[model samples]
Target: MSPPLRIALADDQALVRAGLKALLESFGDLVVAIEAADGAELIAALKATPVDVVLSDIRMAGLAGPEAVRCLRRDGDGTPVILLTTFDDSTLLLEAVEAGAQGFLLKDAAPEDLHDAIVAVARGESLLQPVATDPVRARYAYRDQDAPKANFNEREIAILRLLAGGYSNKEIARSIFLAEGTVKNYVSDILDKLGTRDRTRAVLKAITLRVI
Candidate 1:
């Protein structure tokens, strides 16, 4: 069998953190290797000891999940993150994902959803999910395919898949043998075609449209 996946977990309430730790560990092949009460501590602990995935609360007394994720990605840490939230705040949820989280779950999610989300991002696939379908999240994300066909060419489709995998423009350029500037221009066109402002939203729409 493969080694168990290591997870770094962060949440402000000690009791909540402990309960979540237990629940996560109860799932075989997963372990909470690091724990923290807030985002700042989570980031510090991660810098000291990296893990396969990060499961963090979206709002905390310090740094907050979105800001913390922004910091990690800014410093070149590509570790995938799945954020948790109790509130049904679409704005905050979008902020966290846009800041580089691989996915987010409502704090009340069933154990299997949590387990599956962790495994998905750990394997470099976008969860774009939580197995228990959340209605509030449904409001802003993943509607029926309504976009007019983007008619993306083969190259644009390839770039969209890379974006879903969270590749940076430079990384995508290197992978496809194009200049970074050219990749950026293509991304801009993709966003325009999809009517979204950022790559994360673009990918979400692409998935909804089944274009990627």
Candidate 2:
């Protein structure tokens, strides 16, 4: 049998950490190998133990979750990290994605949803909680209504939609039967046309401007 996926849990509240650890252990396919009260402790735990993924609370007292993910990315650590937050704030969610989090989930997510997020992130798939989707859509609704439409070809539009749906470049290429390098070029064009610096902003700008 394949070994269980090792997860590191980080949260400032002791009870919250205990509860999350218990819940992850209950999944049978998951094992909590490290626990930390804040992002610094999380980094230390990572240095001490090899883990498959990290699950961190977004608003801890020290080195917030997004910052930790950024630090990991800056250091060339590609381990997938998932961010948990209490509020369904789209801005924070986007920041987490930009900071290299593979998943964004609310603290009150269902046990099954949390488990599924862990699994998805481990597989290099991206996910955002369903409850958080509408608010983001709503937040961009006014912008969508007011913004001038930018020109996008059919393929670019399809790719933009997939990007907004959290599909990685490899996944997008697979879905559309395009070469990965070609997809990268297309993504660059999309970003240039949207006047955004990165994929997250490109997707948000596309949505806000109704370009996709």
Quick one: best TM-score, which candidate?
2
lDDT of 2 by residue, 131-162 (tens): 34554555555444443564788899999888
- lDDT string, candidate 1, 1-212, tens digits: 99889999998889998998898888778888999988889889999997999999988997789899999999899999998888756566567767999887777777887887788778764544322224334545654445655478889999988876656676789999999999989998999888887666787677666676
| Residue pairs with clashing backbones, model 1 | none
The C-alpha lDDT values of all candidates are 0.79, 0.82
Best by lDDT: 2
Off by over 4 Å in 1: 130-147, 150-200, 206-212
Worst 10 residues of 1 by lDDT: 128-137
Model 1 Cα RMSD, 1 decimal: 8.8
Instruction: Give the range where candidate 2 is weakest over 10 consecutive residues by summed lDDT.
Output: 141-150
Per-prediction TM-score to the true structure, in the order listed: 0.67, 0.70
